[model samples]
Structures are given as structure tokens and as C-alpha cells.
Target: MFAAIIAAGVCSCYYDSEEGLYPSISSTCDTTNVTYSGKVVPIFANNCLSCHSNARAASSGGSVALENFADVSAQAASISAAINQTGPLSPMPKNGSKLKACLITTFDIWVRNGKPNN
Candidate 1:
């Protein structure tokens, strides 16, 4: 009876789906209408601006400026690589955690969409 009870208890443990375990990992990331001002800038503001903004670029950002649209646009590929923590470039947020996959996907979509300022 004791052995049966223990086996039943062990078997009763619930298994969580990946999505349930990580609710933030969305299966469908809406990348349509991604724009520099609306999407890209906010991502930079939240993550890169601290070190890569114009004011701080020369000091802590290794001279990389991500505050303005022009600079951001020019370095879009590098930025993507860095944030995605891929390729030869250093992973961004530099010493911090990588950006969420959705955010990276959004950036890639923005880049693909000709990198509009809107």
C-alpha cells in the first residue's frame, strides 16, 4: 500500500508546456508596421541609450551613437547582430542580458522594411 501510494504521488507531478513556463515567449510576434520612432527608438531608449546615446557615446559606448535615426539606421545591421548576440560583434546591452527574442525579431522586421523613420 505504501509503495503504491508513493508511485501514485510521483506520477501525479504535472508537466508544464514551454509556453506556460515562459509566458513571455510568444509564438507569434507581430512585426508588421515596425518603425524607427515607434519601435526601434523605444528599444534603444530602454536598452542602448544609457551607454550609446550621443551624450554618453564617446565615453561608455565605444563612440557608437544610437540616439538619432541616422546613426541608428547606418548601424542597423551591426546593432541587430550585437543585440542578437550573433556573428563577430560583441553582444549588446554589454555585460547585460540579451534582449528578448521578440524584440530582436521586431528590429529585424524594421530593418527589412527599409528602416523607415515613421
Candidate 2:
């Protein structure tokens, strides 16, 4: 019984690492050449489009349309603020989890590059 208890204690002492739990969460994020269509759009599609899409914008996105380049460009600064969960703006994605660090970095790079349409 004592040996069984020792084994149980050892087994229970397993460490949980963020990277180990989230294998898909990459450590190295390449932010080079970030673009509106290629990088930005896909990020929006995955995290923001459900509510901020053209169709859903009116009813669920608080009328904030992120479905296209023009709309996104207009709100680029605020979008960046929201994604970073900083400044006075509310954190984006409402009840959803914050975007991955790599994704946020990519968005920041895109915005810094003058928010190109490409």
C-alpha cells in the first residue's frame, strides 16, 4: 500500500506546460511580409469574421465590419488596440479567447506597414 501511494504521488506530480498542452501554438511566428489579404484576412476569418463579417456585422458585430479591406483600414488603429486588449477600447472577440501572440504580432506588423490592401 505504501509503494502504491508513492507511485500515485509520483504520477500525480506531472507538470503541465503551455506549449505541451497547446502543441499547435507555435513559438516562432514569422511576421515578415504580412498583408491584408494573405495574413490579415485569414486572421479575421478565424477570430473575428463570425461576428464581424459583412452579413453579421449589423446584428452581432456592433456594426463593426471587418470583412473587407476598406472597412478594416478605416478601423485599423482601434482594431489593433482591441486585439492587444489595451488602451480604452474593449478587448475584441467579446467572450472569446484572446488571439495568439503570433497572430497579434502579425496584425501589428500589417498595421505598422500602413495597412496595405495587398
For residue 73, model 1's alpha carbon misses the true position, in angstroms, by 0.4
Give all candidates' CA lDDT scores: 0.83, 0.83
Candidate 1 lands at a TM-score of: 0.75
Of candidate 2, the 10-residue stretch with the lowest lDDT total is 14-23
TM-score of 2: 0.75
Report how far off residue 26 is in candidate 2 (Å).
7.2
Q: Compute each candidate's TM-score over C-alphas.
A: 0.75, 0.75
Model 1 deviation from the true structure expressed as Cα RMSD, one decimal place: 9.9
lDDT of 1 by residue, 87-109 (tens): 89999999999898888878877
* Candidate 2 structure lDDT: 0.83
